[model samples]
Target: NPRDYKSYKLLFGNEKFYDRSSNITLNYEYFYSCIDNMNISIDQLMSSIQKLQFMVVNLNSPDDDPQLIFESLNSTGVALTDADKIRNFLLMNENLPEQNKYFQNYWQPLEENTHFEVSKFFRYFLTIKNAQFPKISNVYDEFKTTYNNLDFDKQNLFEDINDFSNTYKMILECNTGTKKIDVILNRFLELNVTVIRPFIMAIINDFVSNKIVEEEAIKIVELVEKYIARRIITKTPSNALNKVIATLYRDFRQFQDKHNNQYKDSEVIIFLLLKKQGSGRVPTDEELIRNFKHNDWYNINSSYRSYIFERLENHNHIESLSIYEGLKNKDYSIEHIMPQKLSSDWKNELGNNYQRIHENYVNSLGNLTITGYNSKYSNRSFQDKQNMEKGFKESHFVNLNKLPARSDKWGEAEIIERTNQLITSALEIWDFPESTIHEMIEEKEMYIYDGNETFSNYKIHGFTFINDEYIPVKTWKGLFVELFKLLAKIDLNPLIECTKIDTKIGFESAIFSEKTDDTE
Candidate 1:
């Protein structure tokens, strides 16, 4: 009893009082005081703990069903986890010897290797088979229904689960024992893109089963990365991605079957993703490029911003630095070249329309760069930032800092130039997948944008925004109205702000107003 007290004291020591990860605090002093009164206090505590009553049900008859009883009894309590029910149902009917064999061969290894994430494993595994994610609360019932529907023995089901669990483990660990695959896996993990895992696991399963080579599998993962990265940049809603990624592999397989498996897996994936329409369509190169300049990327997910900068700096380089490590170590940060808070010097350098310039490009990619001198560079003028030690001129990120270091002025024109440069590099990093199969898609009559084109010379059929579905335009006024409607749907605050600024819309009267008579 004294030895047990000492062991537990070591576990709940003063140094172990608080856990940051779980946000739990232990009252180690009280615990130690109770244990210090060992003989009297612990004896009373142990007696009370031992005397606590628990109802035990005994199933003595041949017709007794332990699984049903277990489910019924646990219906109102702390609630058994899906994993608990699944594990019990798996071994509940077997004799002790058979249970031990199955536990040792399949279930135990799966539990341990997945780091006890069997519930999540079951959900992803079921998603692969069903092409839809099971509700978190319904995982047990969903898996039970799946088990009953299929003609499967315990060994066959166990084998399938055990095999898939190994792949799932690699994904969770982000270490697939192959450096190339692991790198992409790390990106997916960093972005917290959990919805893509079922499809990723399916591809990895193919690679393991010898259905596809390692190279092709790597290509497919990279393709998926491009898909995800583009969608994020184009500001696509994440809720739509789950359905797209869940059904992608099934659709690919069906497409392959139809073509008699003539196409490579990567080619099939490209065609399948390209064929997607509406909210599910893959963002094209043009859309990605446009978003790079237009979107306030600095305010998006920090992990996504890190991924973009890292790829831009390191892609095709002879030497690479880990931007993630630099950022985490506090030795680097995102620097706004055009400082967020402008001083008189910055205002003068930016010219008379400084407020407009700052509002437009302050958080855009061109005005941002990673720097080790974040504190020193704070609110400094552009020339000072360039000339300061360990500033843009001295930064090791040659791809990012080089062009800006050479620039003499920082203003709207400079931001636009730098943005165009960054956009070019971004295109190279997250380039669209190309295939002759793309030519197979029927083209809509999209008129090219030329400054000299007149509405009177040609009939405008429709227009599209960011590669979305075409919206028909019957008149120039109709086109103007529809464009504003789409923009208002996205965000009306910018439109409302436009009415307050005289220079914004170049109109004699307010274009948007609360009163209908306020505008001509």
Candidate 2:
């Protein structure tokens, strides 16, 4: 237990898990299973394994980073995971009593709750605590580098991580216990939106600590739900989600600071989320409608279709199919009313516009549905396909599939009709909650004045210039012009004399006309 993660889990695992991989059975059972597969006697296998040599690495000074030692020994092909390296760094140097104490109190529970995904837990922890995202490949190094410079309480850091990991597991495993929250969590997992975990962890921590009420926590999570779903539905660039989510913990705290911490937690989250514009913006209803009609969503993404069908299928009911459970993800498949690989029968149904129709609707909402019998009755003529078992007519997913089933013939007209029907239902499913959105404050464009102010040369927003670097009456424009004039005697102007302009903030367009001591 005072050793590495493999042994720590075995000793403190309550007989629930075995070495390194956290297998639930005993370590001997695993070795026996390997022996059974190899068809070798246990005695001979033990003899051969005993002959294999291993090295025990020691650090002469506690000042030596175990991380360096790990890298040196890892060349022997027994490399540790990022999770293992982090735990080793955390516990390797601690004294014996505290070592086992932290292991039993924190590390053991972390492994059990996260199902041994301690690396992912650490990633989310770092993202929230650091107010920025870290590369998963160097999680241990980033954590180590940041901590050495940060003025934080070390024991408090460990305890906070211990607490946050509990809620983190709830979010990751979708076992948050509150039905409303779990539904949102499951939807996030279904969409493969793990990037939001760090932000959600902050929210859940606040809720668990009673910094905010349960209602407020649910509202914030729901806002995150809308923010992500709208982006997916509108086919927004996927790269932006990581940056937006990474700094949300930072943004939320800044909001509280600016507002004197008086604003409702939910409102601050909603306002900041709605504040995201350009690529990071939550797509509006009109944009969602346009994107739904024209976007080649099927080709762009397949998971959303299943998510869409699953939600819309149960939209009306008080209780219906749960995608989190085995019902939807397991039983239903993304069925294409018009198959992606074209067939003659489906082509005739499309009529003269077969190529055009198929191209437009191949992966769109109108063409796709969640069905049980996808392979059994795929790409056949509509009447024949509908009459078969698990037909669209009998399909429980109604909004998209049922419309196509009811249509007399499948063609361009039918596809357009079905897309419109889907749009009507989808509007309610991914709708951004109505909020009094804060208007974005525009930057004031104040022209710099160079009239009748005598001053010694000074740094203009940190761009230092000497006394009278330009003519005494000077503004930023004139400052640039004066420098350009001096450099014009050559064909190539490689050396720059003045600092590049600071465009966004604290631009003091100044003058040296008023010369005085302490002129600022």
- Among the numbered candidates, top TM-score falls to 1
Backbone clash numbers for all candidates listed: 0, 7
TM-score of each: 0.77, 0.73
The digit string of per-residue lDDT tens for model 1 on 192-311 reads 888899999999988888888888898899999999988888986565576678789898898788778888889989887877655677888889878887889788789989988888
Where model 1 places Cα greater than 4 Å from the true spot, the runs are: 1-43, 438-520
- For model 2, the superposed segments whose C-alpha errors exceed 4 Å read 2-78, 149-152, 322-330, 339-355, 387-389, 434-520
lDDT of each: 0.80, 0.71
Residue 367 lDDT (model 2):
68
Q: Assess candidate 2 and give its TM-score to the true structure.
A: 0.73
lDDT of 2 by residue, 129-163 (tens): 77767876778888787768767766777788788
lDDT of 2 at 511: 25
